[model samples]
Target: MNVAFFLIPKKDIVYLKEKSTMRQALERMEYHSYSAVPLIDNDGKYVGTITEGDLLWKLKNTPGLTFHNTEDIHLSEVEQHVQNLPVTIDAQIEDLISRAVVQNFVPVVDDQQTFIGIVRRREMIEYCSQLLLQRKVE
Candidate 1:
């Protein structure tokens, strides 16, 4: 099956711009109640995934940095603790499943590495569950 079968299109997803501040990331994550969110470039390419842990580490490691000063910290300066590698839109279900094992959501990109959407783990589990049920019913 095509990877797009499990995609949650980018249009429906919340993402941060590459140049956005860490403060912006925190605010967006808070509003959406998501621990992690995808990072997109100015050209709309998938860059990486940023999580609450990354922010925490940044705050902990940066000397004299406070929440109030987060606005001055750009997303580019913060290292993503986890880089959930993106898969092409045409990737197979097997490939998606492998990546899903490590990521809550797998980033989906086009041939040119343009950000397109994501394949969530819950969706993959449900798809696998349905497949198994069908086999049993056969």
Candidate 2:
């Protein structure tokens, strides 16, 4: 099956721009209760992913940094520890399993490397589980 079938389109998900402030990222992440979110460039291309750990580390490493001052810090300043590898729209289901194993959600990009959406690991797992159950029933 095509990976796109499982894609949660960009319009339905929350993503942050590289130029956004650290405070904004924190607020968005907190509001959505997401541990991580996809980061995009000014041109809407996938840059990387930012996680709660990244923010915590940034706060710890930056001296005199506080919640009040996060607004002054750009998300670009936060170091992303996870590469959060992305797959192309044409990629197959088999192509996504390994990545899904390590990531909460696999970022999906188009041929131009534009940030299209994400394929949540839960979706993949449920699909596979359904297939296995069907085989057992047969």
Candidate 3:
């Protein structure tokens, strides 16, 4: 299947700009109910990913840090150990499943290599369930 069919379009994704603060990132994650989110540069390039674990680490490492103080910290300042999973607009469902297993979400970029969208684990599971149900009916 076309990766685009399974991908959550960039418009539907909850991403954080490079300049966004940890607090803002946290809020977005909470609002979207996502464990991790993709990070994009000013030009809308895919930079990396930030996770709930990264936020926890930041909170623990920076004792007494406040939202006001987070301005001093950029998304780039926080080290994100993100997986560089293969991103292809034509990726197969099996390929997506493999990538999703390793990384909760795989970042999707356009032909220009611009940040586009993501394929979440939950989305994959839901898709698989639907496919199985359809198979059973057939």
**Candidate 2, superposed: residue stretches over 4 Å from native:** none
Instruction: Tell me the tens digit of each residue's lDDT in model 3 across 1-138.
Output: 778887788998688897888878877888888788888999988888888888778767887877667666777777776654648777778888888778888888887778889888888999999999999999
Instruction: List all candidate RMSDs to the true structure.
Output: 0.8, 0.6, 2.2
Winner on TM-score between 2 and 3 is 2
Of the pair 2 and 3, which is ahead by lDDT?
Answer: 2
lDDT of candidates 1 onward, in order = 0.93, 0.96, 0.81
Best by lDDT: 2
Candidate 1 to truth, TM: 0.97
TM-score of each: 0.97, 0.98, 0.83
Using lDDT, rank the candidates from best to worst: 2, 1, 3
Clashes of each: 0, 0, 0
Residue-level lDDT of model 2, residues 1-138, one tens digit each, is 999899999999999999999999999999999999999999999999999999999999999999999999999999999999999999999989999989999999999999999999999999999999999999
lDDT of 1 by residue, 17-130 (tens): 979999999999999999999999999989999999999999999999999999999998999989899999999999989988989999999999999999899999999999
Off by over 4 Å in 3: 63-68, 84-86
Q: Global CA lDDT of candidate 2, please?
A: 0.96
